[model samples]
Target: MTIDFTQQALQVLQIEATAISQLARFVNDDFNKACQLIMDSPGRVIVSGMGKSGHIANKIAATFASTGTPAFFVHPGEASHGDLGMITKDDVVIAISNSGETGEVLTIIPVLKRIGAHLIGMSGNPASTLARLSDVHVCVQVEQEACPLGLAPTASTTATLAMGDAMAVALLNARGFSADDFALSHPGGSLGRRLLLRLEDVMHTGNTIPMVPTTATIKTALLEMSAKGLGMTTVVDKHGVLQGIFTDGDLRRILDQRYDIHDTLITAVMVRNCITAQPQMLAAEALKLMEQRKINGLVIVDQHQHPVGAMNMHDLLKAGVL
Candidate 1:
């Protein structure tokens, strides 16, 4: 008889999903108190657990840190060997144990209480020692393990992880954490670029901005565009106020119109009343605008309608706004 691997995988998924869905009932008054505990604390959060719960605890700590709460994970095994010094009276400790009887974690509880740090226990068994000893208890109890052996911590870990996310999100909303605030802590990733980067940050500035006077010939505009390497040129008046814009696309369109490049004034052939952007606009917002208008570039203008910068689709791509 052949065992169906796909059916077993489906069973595992269903069990885990049900386990997570049932976690809603576990978010009780104790959960509300835990959130208030973290919020009211002036110190960082120190999360601790052993084995599989340790991994889940580590991820929960990361989520807390990224979502505006100061948090870090400490290995319970290491805590017994002088690492417990990292915890202080002002900090909040999140202790995780599915059975709530893990020796290393239990061993540190006495020291933590001596240090006066508040304890929040996450355990499957509400009657477990950890729950009984903790200042507050969060139940991550699941009906059954997704593992066929009922020993691999599958559904329990899933439930615990979901509970951690729910906690982080609740705290996040309470703190009014914004994406820009998150980007400050995660500055090297695409998410940071999307949240923190503005139009002025990516747009070509000063002499690099491609521009030609409105009276300049189409040839002058092409020269400016080529020199700036932006594939487009802003047409400004004598006062440097934006008049219009010209681009490679404009060149291509005018090619069919039989215009003399050197003799035709840029204003005569340039797109009049062209789309523009403010320097303070978000690069992501600008990308959306460009996509909506089916445009390749935008001229950055000041409040007085003076051209201050210029950017193209390639600039946005280079800045990771795409």
Candidate 2:
């Protein structure tokens, strides 16, 4: 007999949807109590479970740790064999079991309690032994299993996972956690580069900067722009202080005005009020300013207002700051 793939998929979706819908009812005072308990914990939150619930517990622990709550996942079976030593008085223990009676998890409860760890029990049964012994019981109960066999933890696991995320995000908001703090834990991601990388790390410096003195002709500025390939040249005084910028846009305007490119001084045709960035500013912030001003490039200056470096939209793009 061939299986009806569409029917099977619809059945799974129906079951999972019902499970998620039922989670709203679980968001009562007890949920707040659980959040409050975890928020008050002074040490790490140790999440432990068995079977599929254990898998979800590990993800929950990771979410908590990345969002500013110190947390980790421990195997209940390992806990019974001396891994319980990792539990400290300054830690909180979260135990997950669909039936609330996983023998392995139950075996470690006494040790966790003895160590003065606060217990948060997540289960489908509110009156189970785990819930009865917990400092806070978070009911992740569902009406039925998404599994056709009604044996695999399906609906209950979905509800449990959502509740775990709710707990983590709530604590994150309450703690005033920032993106910069989150980036520290995820230094390899794009968000980390935006938050931690400074403009000086990517801006063009030395001979790479397109620069010309105020006495230089528009033709001379054009040569500097072409050689540096930045499409613009910074108009500086003899002291190297930036006075203005002559971009391709400025060149177009000058030509339209019939200025003599060979005889006209760059300062006479340059756009005075050019957008600038500080060397110490965050590259991400510079990108934001560029976007807001609708400009394609910026001159980076030192504390003394001397032009030291420059970058354009292409530079930010190449650096992945775009």
- Alpha-carbon TM-score of each model against the true structure: 0.92, 0.94
Q: Which pairs of residues have clashing backbones in candidate 1? A: none
lDDT string, candidate 2, 1-322, tens digits: 9777998789888988888878888888888888888888788999999989999999999999999999999999998888898889989899999899999999888888788999999999999999998988899888888787898888888889998998999899999999888989988978888888888998899989999999999889999999999888898888988899988887776667888889988878899878888998988999999899988889999977788899888988887777
Candidate 1: count of backbone clashes, pairs at least 3 residues apart or interchain: 0
Off by more than 4 A, model 1: 1-3, 252-262
Task: Give a tens-digit lDDT track for model 1, residues 1-322.
Answer: 9877999899999999999999999899999999999999999999999999999999999999999999999999999998999999999999999999999899999999999999999999999999999999999999999888888999999999999999999999999998889999988999889888999898888999888887899888888888989889998889999989888888888888888887989889889999998999999889999999999988999999998888888888889878
CA shift at 162, candidate 2, in angstroms? 0.9
- Model 1, poorest ten-residue lDDT window? 253-262
- lDDT agreement of model 1 with the native: 0.93
State candidate 1's TM-score: 0.92
In model 2, which range of ten residues has the least summed lDDT? 249-258
